[model samples]
Target: MLDIFRGLKSLIKISHIHIDSAVFRLHYSLTVILLIAFSLIVTTRQYVGNPIDCIHSKDLPEDVLNTYCWIHSTYTITAAYRKREGLEVPFPGVDNSKSYSETERKEYKYYQWVCFMLFLQAILFYTPRWLWKGWEGGKIHALMMDLDIGLCSEVEKKQKKKMLLDYLWENLRFHNWWAYRYYLCEVLALLNVIGQMFLMNRFFDGAFLTFGIDVLRFLESDQEDRVDPMIYVFPRMTKCTFYKYGVSGEVERHDAVCILPLNVVNEKIYVFLWFWFLFLGVLSFFTVLYRILIIFSPRTRVYLLRMRFRLVRRDAVETIVRRSKVGDWFLLYMLGENLDTVIYRDVMHELANKLASRHHHGVKGELQEA
Candidate 1:
């Protein structure tokens, strides 16, 4: 188990440079790592101890009854949740009486599938990053022109700066598709979070969507009136029925009280995930909204550039914004993120001057022609 977790530690390390927002990295990197770690921890028998254990009658084989209950799943009586734990019910869902109707019993089968489901969810969270990386195809890296390494020779730095400026001048407005793809990936991340939440709700028999909310409400409610949402959703104890043949060839029904130790880990994992997904959903939502602002408002682009690279002059930023399209600004903004602020300021100043010169020359030619 220590070796496995040590391997997982490598995944959480910052092994590569990131070209996306923190929120984006949260989805593809941190969230994926967390999900996989939880899955592995739960799947490991040493950590989880036993998946399920049941108390059986002296007549029944304990191992056989435990295995049967684990394979077939266990159930909780709904009305038992309202009863006090120490008084009417030994636990949240344990009942020895056979008087409860089948309609009142809720079967729990999610435990067996928890690890598999978590792995699947990790893949889903990473899908957007994969798509974005494929579509981006090293565009930012190629355009960076080794400027990311600021220790280059002065001659090389000058030459690289000229090349970068020339590329920007020649390719203005051409990066709309590239920028759009990244934005689309951001939107996809938000959708993926929402979709996963919905899937988890269904997977947990509709208990997950509001799991966090119920937990919060439970925390604030009077203890006497409250039913623990965690226990309700992930009961630590439940009832299972196993059947076998008697010595006389008659069928015997054995009711067993099963303890689900895995749910202890499960409840914590999901409660944290519920809050995390909600946070990511909101962050992604605002990120998309900010993207829309960047698209529709030129002043927003100028303001963002100025804010991000304070050394860049306001007029220089405005000049670039005035002369370029949203795609060009987006590319430049991304480039600014990769380049040092001082170097970026120099690049922006030179680009602004070059654009001004071009505009002047074009106007002079038109005047001469007229």
Candidate 2:
């Protein structure tokens, strides 16, 4: 444990963490912001708005009120009834609360579960990034930070840039095996996006599971005064019944309406979230393919490097990448498809130049000293 802390301290001292890509932005930053904002909107609206409106016998007992609140927080069956001989009997009527078919309660009390589930989904999306960071051991961030800092150095004679690149490709010097951290992150990101499509369905409506195939596309917005128990993007208007039996063989009933103010926020947020995930999923798939292709194809890597560096010949890039010991992982790390080309072209150019210089100057014998 002590050794681990010392290593962590050294890692932090070496370089700061970098977010690295758009996939990261979606999983960590955007997911968190969306979850928190939606959750808060739901919660705050309930506190300030009339979320539950119960229509029942006035001046009811305290126990009945408690029961009404409890059932109102959950899903309750709604139906119609007609009064006969002082007894309320089930009968269909447009204004009567007693004639609707049985419906299951929502899986929430006051829509708390919706936000809770969304928050859980956010956590799920974040887990891959958390795992990647754990495996990174701070090396990726350190390399980028060191390179960025050194690239801006006023000391032209300093070898800090070269030393940093050497550190990045060190295993290449000894083991001939490249560290595959970046590819692993990309693969994990792709999986996270795919898994979320399934995982979120369990928490959300069937439309999400079916990619909106199972959703009802009706505009019943004008019927706010009526009980509409159909599912939509905003499920605000629902009704339930509360029953209480007195010890003296007397029974009373309360039919109440349940509303979630957060439904408004959820309606807009989920629509956006669904499309955003789809877009991100497709992008991640291509990224996975790109990583796999570059890792296996030397010519492809050389071609990309030629485009990236603009000066290195194909043979030169290939020999330097293979002989000077740049692994698929580190090379891709610098040439990541997601990296901003303009901001990072200088760093990659420097690396290409170093490899070319090393080969041109016949410096293989001095490799140990480097």
Candidate 3:
């Protein structure tokens, strides 16, 4: 048990080198850990405590009645949510109506599967990271070439810088595929969040997509106009019909009021997730747009590099941006993030000078030939 918790703890540990963006990390690490934690909490409470208790007649065995109702399922009256509590009904979704048909009863099966669903969602959230890791295969880390460490000997530093620059020059204009793979991962993250919202709506019988919006409106609406979305979605009090043999060996219907303590925990968990997913969706949408800008606009790349390192001059940044394709620029951007600021600045300066001199020599030879 201790080992299990320790493993979960490791999921949130910060990595020394980051190959992905902040939003990407949030999707794979913090969001995954939170979902798993919620799943465990719900599973533990459902099994360790009395998840359901029903008020039944003295003649019926309490344990058997409770077990039967829990396993077969409990339901809420669809019309009761519209009725005022304490006046027309004892509790929201707990009506004593003889005219209610089976169709009027909305049986909740999601409560039983909540833990498993949550765990599955955690896996979905990590899928993009898994795909990206396989495709990335430590490319950035390999190119970093220990430039992250600034205390190396001067000779070693120069040699490493030359080797890195030579590779970048050789591989110029060939990195579009690599960079596009990462952008595809970002797009997948956005799609996953949107897809999960719809999945939860289906899981909750189509009440999840607008859950956060409904809650916000409920808070701002007048008291008389307010309807608790949480109660409507996860009713605490419900009804169950149990059948048994009576004194004359005839069948009898026993209506019992069941209190679901698990729903109380479930309501809070989903409310938090509703708002959290909305936030992630908005963030991821903009992240994709930002990536598009980076791909299409070379000037944006120049500005970003200059902003990231103030010491890197505008002309040098522009020269590098003009000479390199999107893939080379992306690789240099990532290296800037991982490498020491001073080392990155020096490398960029030297690479810019070499590329500029090569361009000058090519133009001079062309003029002489003419």
Candidate 4:
């Protein structure tokens, strides 16, 4: 028991020693500052305007005022719906059917503010790592190019081809499996999107009325019509419009004739884009799946057996050649093994000698020899 306790103590001490002081301090400071800044921003944004004041104002409805209050509170925290109009609007509710208390609004606003700050911080933190990975990938690509050039000797061609075949075989195992699954998923998503289109149409029809005559006409009509409908209709519509001549009794409706067609076209375009993107994504996914399956499948086992048989046949031929000329075979084997190491040097020397020979022999003799 004492030994176990001692071991735990040692492990803890080792872990503590491994922790970098600079990194730990920097992380702690950044976390503290982020927290402090977020809190301050949230607090300021939340209670900037009083919900009670907006509610009491005759210019807006109780529901509208309450909605503004609620939205202000909610967005102060979440901030997902943050927009220029949202900031200016006294009420935050979409259609003003709901009202928010001052306390609720404040809390919501704070929540949104915190959410926004966290989202921004997350992006900032991840961007550096993403950039570093891109740089490393570029360097790796350059290294691969150098390696390919160095390895491109005639003697090393057979070995290089064998290595490439091995790599392809391994990758194919994963690809095959991935392709099958990806095809299945793509078919399902296509069916789902088709089903959703019908449902989306119904949803738009239901919601369209609210935005059309109700909201637009209210904006296009006179001041009396613009006044809170609940206040005017429930209490005194006759008194409100009594003095105005030819007020048409019918509210001046702003024809959103363009809206329905525009919305339909937009929806069609969005669905088209969605299908296109989903198809591309599935194509890529399937390609990878097919490669994976080829690498791991039983079918690949048979393919590898064939490869082994071919390799053995080639080895037998090489063995016969080696037996016929043992010394030459040993030299050839050594040269093949270190082909990349000597290829550039040999090429340069050979080219220089040829050029010198050509200079001495003259262009006519050099051409005849070639």
lDDT of 1: 0.88
Every model's Cα RMSD, please? 1.5, 9.1, 1.8, 21.9
What is the Cα-based TM-score of model 3? 0.95
User: In lDDT terms, which candidate is top?
Assistant: 3
Q: Per-residue CA lDDT of candidate 4, range 328-348, in tens?
A: 222222223333434423322
Estimate the TM-score for candidate 4: 0.22
- How do the residues 1-370 of candidate 3 rate in per-residue lDDT, one tens digit apiece? 3455677876777867888999999999989999998898888888887889999999999999988988898888888887888898899888875878878888877888999999999999999999999998998898787889888999999898888888887888899898899999999999999999999999999999999899899899998768899988988988999999999999999999999999999999999999999999999999999999998999999989888889888999999999988888888888898998888899889989989999999999999999
lDDT of each: 0.88, 0.54, 0.90, 0.33
Candidate 1 vs candidate 2: the TM-score winner is 1
Candidate 1 lDDT over 87-200, as tens digits, reads: 988997777557788889999988888999999999999999999989889878887877876889999999988988899989987888888999999999999999999999
Candidate 1 regions with alpha-carbon error over 4 angstroms: 13-16, 45-48
lDDT of 2 at 331: 41
lDDT by residue (tens digit), candidate 2, 2-99? 44234333322321345355565566666666665565566555565555554446655544554466454544332231223134522112123344
Lowest lDDT sum, 10 consecutive residues, model 2, at 77-86
Clashing pairs in 2: 75-105, 79-97, 79-98, 79-99, 79-100, 80-98, 80-99, 81-98
RMSD of 1: 1.5
Where does candidate 2 stray beyond 4 Å? 1-19, 61-110, 144-157, 165-170, 173-181, 211-233, 246-249, 311-315, 324-370
